[model samples]
Target: MYFEKIDSLNDLKKLSIEQLKILADEMREVLLLKLSSHGGHIGPNLGTVELIIAMHYVFNSPIDQFVFDVSHQSYVHKMLTGRKQSFLEARHYDDVSGFTNPDESEHDLFCIGHTSTSISLACGLMKARDLRQEKNNIVAVIGDGSLSGGEAYEGMNNVVEVGTNMIVIVNDNEMSIAENHGGIYQNLKLLRDSKGKAECNFFEALGFEYFYIENGHDMNELVTTLKKVKDVEHPVVVHVHTIKGKGFKFAEENKEMYHAGPPFDRKSGKYIYPLDNPESYPAVTAAFLMEQIKKNPKVAVLNSGTPGGFGMNAEWRKEAGSQYIDVGIAEEHAVAMASGMAKNGVVPVLNVYSTFLQRAYDQLSQDLCINENPAVILVYLASVYGMNDKTHVGIFDIVMLGNMPNIVYLAPTCVEEHFAMLKWAMTQREHPVAIRVPAKEFISSGKEDTTDYNKLNKFAVTRHGRDVAIIALGDFYTIGRDVADKLKAECNMDVTLINPKFISGLDTALLDSLKKDHKLVVTLEDGVLEGGFGQKIASYYGTSDMKVKNYGIKNSFPDRYNVEELLIENGITVEKIAEDMEKIIG
Candidate 1:
């Protein structure tokens, strides 16, 4: 096998044209086997096999730097590098990360997971190269989906000023997680239709020499085009139009579903562990949004690129029609646009993953919160149970949005409370509201929440007890409840359990009351302890006689960690917390 014969890029360079073509087929087979078993970016990696191969054939990597935007599509790049064993063997499947990691190989220049950063990163490399008097080519491989981000535009606008060798390969598959959106996509479509002969060129307008390859899958064409711009003295954009899910028929047909997914059956193209949960947050949210859209025309749902992440699938998007807006991969624009929508009269519900939400902190602070626009921002996967990747961890959102002024950050423990908070946020015009959507399993209180969210910072005393009080926020409430039960049964201690729904503000009266009877106050939050909800509580009782013990994930970017192990390490387990509380109480 060509794949077995080749260990590194040097071995790959030894192959003939026919041998390389055979190797491409071999690579695709390996990718499918690994992805179908391990589960990752199937469509993206499949589509980029030939493109990556051509690039590697033309340029010497580790010397000629490659920066992949988002890096989800860098699996083939990893294989071409020295990390092929990670994909070849199932036992070593997880040896390398899903994204491009500099530590994994010298070929990967940056460890990027978020979108629209390659061009800017490449620019920096190019600048440093010139300063060091180096002559290597710096290539930035960015998807058309990423082109919509403001940073990409900023990068394009500035890269021309460097006046050096920088190549930006636009992987146009007419997709950005879901379908591509925004005005720039229209230009991409125009370019695709005109087949490189279009007069109205976006890259050329930005002062970059532009080249287009209609058939990006053609290895010969790709190699020829890449060689022409290998050491070009000016900034250039090589727009390559390739199929998103090229090799797999199912993925080609259902691009969005297969963009990234769980382990699936190769023959039938079905998920091995299918998500059939009707009570899932995504499923529930979609139903709620549909009902709300039918009731109110002013109600709108906005997502940046990842519509499927928030359960806004193709059917949902079509049904919602004008009510739903996929703002491409531009989180900053989505936030600012939500603010604009809320400024008028529309109740814009912006649904974003917690990791992606951090990209628009400036917009959240200045545009949304500063203006006090009553936009409903639903933050998905804002817990330890969310994304485990360091770059995409949802643990930081509590510190990111909870500390912001004029923003009512609500954390609901169950479906009932989440629905209540959502209903309240939709109708309220007093302040901008953000709901931390529970990332854990769906739990139902079995009763409709009657709490008036308008009366903000009101802590709910779920269980009335004495001596020890456990104040939990969001997904961590279950842990607090378990801890309370453990203390009761094992230690024979009656513990007061409280749920702090509001993260941005504290219930001062409730806290003061807790200090009256409770000796030790333990705050549980499914986020970083530093600058988080737990820290806020700890700080409140710092000078007082009340002892506050905060339980949370520490201030570290943990990647692909076991949730149970991580919790135990942080002293967040029921038994550990109970034992600690008893000692503290004594």
Candidate 2:
């Protein structure tokens, strides 16, 4: 009920420490109820309740800008800043995004979902404030896990140059999406053990005045610590050692699983929604990698910081032993390392989310693609169906990777194709191959994919027909199949359905052959239309007599979009395609 009085940060000024503590509990209750009903980043939100409360208590928001790393932990901040209904009520859960968006609130400085850019963003704000000759506090709240990223260090190194009012709050939760990895984590542990009295301090070494809070959950202590550095003339790092999943017992015990999860039972902490098909592309790829690594000493599986999400669980990772490598929130390093491994006759399969892979574009282009390294890069969640956020949209990977030369990017339609392509990419030594794994539920085509990838840019004609030729790339094969079936049944015309597995290049020979019988050529791809697979087809047939139509998502960031509705909106459904075919044929 104390949370009811909190319409803005000014409301926190009136509350006593005891009242603030009470408000934290009420806010947690709301968070628990909302997260339990609808899936969200539960652990981060629950753990940061006190920190956010203290932040509101100390800093003047809108004036004092706060940039959260990853922004998953900003749920508590949202609740305090006139968005309580989003967390408190079930109906209002869809009102706000899972990440911090400037469109949502004036308190939010940036639309951030990806990790480890807080310090840099805050530094920019500090510079802008300085340019305006204004005096206000700027804070960047980052987690211990995010420190493993090169950008965080880059930001920290540059932040010292400002020499003005800046505060970097390090929320030492001791975990990323998975358990923390890399040498920086070891130093963090040392700093935590030393109780801020250590001789070797990373923050201090970076020219930041360091202060550590042993009990980050304590409201009085956090407020006192924050207040001390609120008006500090120079940059400071307030290292707050806090529990990741502090209040909830389930989250405390299983930290990784609780980091983000689906709608679950409040009492039992069991998932309310059941996974219809648990056999995922990641699981299949993990199994294949485990088998390959066990047999071939030269084979290795690599992931940045997220092994569990990519399907290499603790057991599988242990089984992998020395063969498995987690570079720890460093995608750039992982890409570079994979390229190195490939150069030395080792086949390194690097699996990372498509959105996260955006960080290592330069590494992918220069280190791997330019060198033509044979490293197998598995791009997970590279469709419109992947994580729907402005910062984490997986639709742009096709545009990014496909543009790079000497990089063979393949999109697999089914589990068989995926594994087959994986096996080929692992063993081959021609080029750096990246496969866009489908975000849709994994399905077996029941037929073995024995297509020799050595014959690059060769499309497979699943069905041969007349009048219209449909080229479906990767995950859009199912839609293409349905369209073909509808065209045959309704229009009494069979259409040629082609599965162009390769996105990096067009099967121009096969495309030219289609001009004989096919009057209209249609391409379907599950990504943004611009700079995507469909665009390549449209470009190829630009001046040709064959009328080419490309169907795909537009070049826009859609937040938490409905998959079916999005498909319909993009004219990707069988009904829409069939109607188009009828019109074209007529």
Clashing pairs in 1: none
Q: Give me the candidate number with maximum TM-score.
A: 1
lDDT tens per residue, model 1, 1-586? 9898777788988887777788888999999999998899999999999999999998999899999999999998998888889999999998999998878888877779999999999999999999999999999999999998999998988899998999999999998889888899888999999998889988899899999999988888898899999999999999999999889999999998999999999889899987556778888988999999999999999999998877778888999999999888989999999999999999999999999999999999999999999999999999899989888899999998889999999999999999999999999998999999999989999999999888989999999999999999999999999988987887788899999899999999989998788898999999998999988888988899999999899999998888999998898888888888888878
Q: In model 1, how large is the Cα lDDT of residue 448?
A: 90
RMSD for all candidates, in order, please.
Answer: 0.9, 1.3
Q: How accurate locally is residue 342 in candidate 2, as Cα lDDT from 0 to 100?
A: 97
For model 2, the local distance difference test gives: 0.88
Candidate 2 per-residue lDDT over residues 559-580, each given as its tens digit: 7888899989888899988898
Clashes of each: 0, 0
Q: List the residue pairs that clash in candidate 2.
A: none
- TM-score of every candidate relative to the true structure: 0.99, 0.98
lDDT of each: 0.91, 0.88
For candidate 1, the per-residue lDDT at 215 reads: 92
